[model samples]
Target: MSPRKILGWLRAYAAHDDPLVATANLVALVVASNVPFYPVYHLLLIGRDAWPALLEAPVALIFFAIPWVSRRSGLVGRTLPPLVGVANTLFCMKILGEASGNALFLVPCVVAAAFSFRAKERWVMLPLVWLPVAVFLLSIDRMGAPLAPFTDAQFAAMLRLNAVSTGIFVGFLGMLYGRAGIESARASR
Candidate 1:
């Protein structure tokens, strides 16, 4: 392509609505999804010796490639990273199945997507809010356990706490990253 065309493409890709905020939220999503899945898969799939080495490759591809690509071409690199990451997470969740840990990698997506909101984009968090609830309820039903057992209320409480705690964590993360996104947008202009 001509130099002018290349430059135009570069601007489009690296041009985030707010780079720092968007990038931070993206990084957080990458962490949230990869963190829980990594150990769970390691324990369930690769045993003690192999998963560590295998894990770094995709993680590197997702995060490192951002600045690397931006520095090199400045095109669609930043713009596309989040979608690529999400697609990869979905694949991982599917391949790992129950061993993926948590459900379907929904938590991280919800959290990251929340930070993407502008005033016009506020609707994004709605589906995100519902995902975990759906996952938890579905899990409970599929597991065929009572929501709370009277004699062993502690186990039920633990389950309830885990769900609530995770929800709160994701919400807090959404708020923090969302604020960062707003600041980044202001700074960009």
Candidate 2:
């Protein structure tokens, strides 16, 4: 194919409006977010301890592949949303387990799920917001001072606050998006 045709095809692929695309984009954002830290980690020679950050790349690739697989497997509408949600939730838990302060990353994951999945699929996003809190609560003793750079109480409070705030923020955005979508549908009709 010509370069122009390839570009046009790529644009159409990206604009396909599939939930898998949204999920993949969110995962891509997560991968991008890690880019800046890599240089610092390497400069500080802490890259060896930063192995978890390396996992995001492959995860992002898998997320990017999901849309194509779903397109062929007929899983886009039925299975993909929940699968993405669960994967995101697990990813959040892994990050939280590795570093407590990184809990903030869960918010965007939840928000992405909100934007990707329909209202009826909102349940998928809920655990993405809450699982980190549960992990934090369960691992409180091991998360203080040397390991976490915060007191146990402070870390707990921060984790709880982040989870609650993210939930509310994503919920509000979801409602706003839902209303806008409804209005757009009505206008179209």
The per-model lDDT (C-alpha) reads 0.47, 0.46
Tens digit of per-residue lDDT, candidate 2, span 96-116:
343334445445544554454
TM-score of each: 0.44, 0.47
lDDT of 1 by residue, 32-52 (tens): 445455445444433443233
Query: By TM-score, how accurate is candidate 2?
Result: 0.47
Pick out the ten consecutive residues of candidate 1 with the lowest summed lDDT.
Answer: 145-154
- Name the lDDT value of residue 105 in candidate 2: 45
Predicted model with the maximum TM-score: 2
